[model samples]
Target: MAKFTDHDDYIAAAPEQFRPLLGQLRSRLAEVLPDADELIVYDMPGFGFGKSIIAGYAAFSKQCGLYVSNAAITAHADEIVAAGLKFTKTGLTFSPRHPIPDELVTKLALASRRELGV
Candidate 1:
């Protein structure tokens, strides 16, 4: 595999299994941050608004990650943990076989935007 520095490259480099999910996640992100500028960052898809450091999405062999860059994500760490969130070399993610709850995602996005000063 080739080294990728941003999201587009990462998407391109990712295997077939990740393509569809990656696209779905990307669409969801856009829906959440419609006006935000989007690009590839940290070898993953990132959405930026007033600032560049914002949320992102990335997929791996096991599952995909919906990155909420705000420190606020920690506030619900306990709940997420109970719901199966965990520390990974990358970040938090749901298991490959599990579907992320829409309600949880809404909460996370709201928290993330608040952290971003949105």
Candidate 2:
């Protein structure tokens, strides 16, 4: 729906279907990087830890794009390619209709910590 540049803005603009999912993602990111400076940049929910960017969450046309801003997934591109996952250098292109990869998300969260020095 509408674009939001902060959490409260997101809460107000986000669609109902995406709310719970976004909340879960937000909580997960928070738990993973408690010391990070969480902000809503680029109209998406993003977390900034030190000079590093941990991750961000967004509801797209038909999927929720879970973004690891530091290009952490780039390092695993080959593995992702072999696994048949469609992703870019920034984030995994996943459908919200399907289940989220909690395990991989966890790994990315940890990587965010390292990248951000958190």
Predictions: Cα RMSD each: 3.2, 3.0
lDDT by residue for model 2 (1-118), tens: 4566577578556667777777777777777778778886666778884445678877765667777745578666675555556777678765546535566667777775566565
For model 1, name the residue pairs that clash: 7-40
Clashing pairs for model 2 are: none
Best by lDDT: 2
Off by over 4 Å in 1: 1-9, 88-90
* Distance from true location, Cα of 101 in model 1, Å: 1.8
lDDT of 2: 0.69
lDDT of 2 at 104: 69
lDDT of 1 at 91: 48
Cα shift from native, residue 8, model 2 (Å): 3.7
Give the TM-score comparing model 2 with the true structure, all chains together: 0.74
Model 1 lDDT tens row, 6-114: 5566777766777666666666767877877876655556777634645677677787777884464676666566677664432467544555566666566667777
